[model samples]
Target: IEKEGWSGEVSGRRKDGSPITILITASLVKDEKGEPICMMDSFVDITERKFMEDELRIKDNAIASSLNGIVIGDLEGNITYVNDAFMELWGGDDISEIVGKSAVTFAEDEDKGRSIINVLQNEGNWTGEITGIRRDGIPITVQLSAGMVYNEKKEPICMMCSLVDITKRKEAEEKLQRSHEELEIRVQDRTKELTKANIKLKKEIEDRKIAENTLLKKEKELELKSLNLEEANTALKVLLRQGEKDKTELENKVLQNIKELVLPCIEKLKIYRLDDKQQAYLDILESNLNNIISPFLQKLSSKYMDFTPTEIQVANFVREGKPTKEIAELLNISERGIEFHRNNIRMKLGLKNRKTNLRTYLLSLA
Candidate 1:
């Protein structure tokens, strides 16, 4: 009585009273004469099929919402499917805009595209970096992982690919490399500067050492010269002492010769009769000669440092028993000068106010 058969999926209970899902087809069965007899129905268990469909739907949703772009392409490299992420990655508005395109259409280089195809065909998979172009023609870098899909018969059917953006990572790596190179250059420059400074310091130290050595050498030379001068002065002092001793011995010998040889001869000549004027000249000569040769004169000069030469001469004449006028005539000086000199000698001898006579003190010294 129905014009057409009805088919639908329905829920049912199994023999164990468990709930199940099935596909049902119902139609009207007729006997004859176009009269309806009974209704006939067919049931097909679809629980597994429904479950498989639900799982497939969930998987599809996961792929659509993935952060990574996904593509399914035929073995001929034609695009067959694309997820929402893939569309967004390629800057496409809809899957319809990308599904019918060649899989290699977005590859930046034709040669690289061909290579990727060849690797996928031979190895059944390819994973590497690739340059791709967006819908706006902007080039981008990606990490691509692609594999060939197979049928149940193991025949290659299509290629499944996943893409992840790697542009920022590559940029960071390049920046780090540049910074490392710059740091290396700076370290090298600093090392060179330190080396130059070290060299200069070494040179300065060497020059200072040389100056110190020169100063030490000069000091040594001056010390040696001073030592030589000291030795010369010592030798001169010894020679001067020897000369003074020789002069004293010579004066003693001259005084002895006058007393023994010359004075005795003069006394013998006085025994021969001489005129009065001659006798006076002889007395003056004897007095002068005795004064010149007297050891007492040397003793007075040495013992009395304050006595003048004239005072020493007056002392010698007074010691010889000559009066003041006679000593003046012998010395070619005035009598007053002789007396003054005698007075000075007595003062110098510490006998000015004493009762001791100058002549007696002189005789006592002799």
Candidate 2:
């Protein structure tokens, strides 16, 4: 028995036989002789208080455990609570460092923070992207969402806001937008080229139809003139021979002038000191001169339109019996690049996957 008094909380049963919590205070009431007569007791229900405490504890744990930054501020925009994520995001080492400060300290400016609070009060909820500052003075972009908290009586109390780091997401969106713009530009250019090609093709088709009709109209005339066609052919042959002779004479004179005038100038230009790039350009110019004089380039280029200038250079080096290392040094490319060009050239020349030597094939082209 407790002599002074006893006060504690204990589980009890209600009149309806359901469980309840009771806070009990008991003491002994004695006569003047100090002998106990009857015990006095008082009971009060504390179920609601226990329930509220449990709810508050759960809320605190949930807020503290959230992955995203969560902040709770007073009506005046002063911070009351901040979770670990919020502290880390603000470059704070402890909750005490963050709490009691204006929540807008991490925002872009005081005006921006005030605007957010104003919008939340008027609009009941607010969400937007804002530039936030860290305690170390670095800037970061965050998606912020805020809402007004209320009491059980539905009166506005404080503001609770959540922030998410969207820096990487924003970068990715920008990159994708740039790629989309580039693709759109390329598509527009290709469409214009296709439009021009379509117009030219339509013109060619119309010309072909007119030519066919003209041939039909001249068919009877041609038939009627067949008896004199042999004499006409003989005269056409004599005229063609005279034209060929004139053309040959002009070609020989031009070749002689180039050999006498252009060759000397080119040789003189080579006598000056030059860098590797300038020397390479000079070599290419000389190679082109040889190509113009020889029929090899015309024959090969006529067979395949897919050959690139570099591939042709590689092919020329291969034809001259230059090794891959020497060709790479001359062309200022890797040996692997030279080998790749050789393979591409061989594939274009229909010698891929065959035992035929690439150098021998290029020589045959020459």
Q: Please name the candidate that would achieve the greatest lDDT relative to the true structure.
A: 1
lDDT (Cα atoms) of all candidates against the true structure: 0.87, 0.86
Residues 1-366, model 1: lDDT tens digits: 298979999988899998789999999998879778889999899998988899999998988888999998888788988888878888878778888787787899978988898889999999999999998999989999999989889999899899998988988988999999999999999999999999999999999999999999999999999999998999999998999899889878987888888998888888888898788889867876776666576677668968877787788889989899988987789999998898888888999889898899998876
TM-score of each: 0.55, 0.57
Off by over 4 Å in 2: 1-4, 15-17, 30-35, 136-138, 207-225, 230-366
Model 2, C-alpha of 149: deviation from truth (Å): 1.7
Q: What tens digits encode model 2's per-residue C-alpha lDDT throughout 1-366? A: 456789999987789998788899999988999999999999999988988888999999999999889999988789999899988888877788778988777787779888888888787788989988888898878899899999999898999999998878888999999999999999999999999999999999999999999998899788879867988989999998998799768766866777788878889999999999898889878877677456676567656769998997788788878899999988899999998999899889999899999888877876
Clashing pairs in 2: none
Model 1: ten consecutive residues of lowest lDDT:
288-297
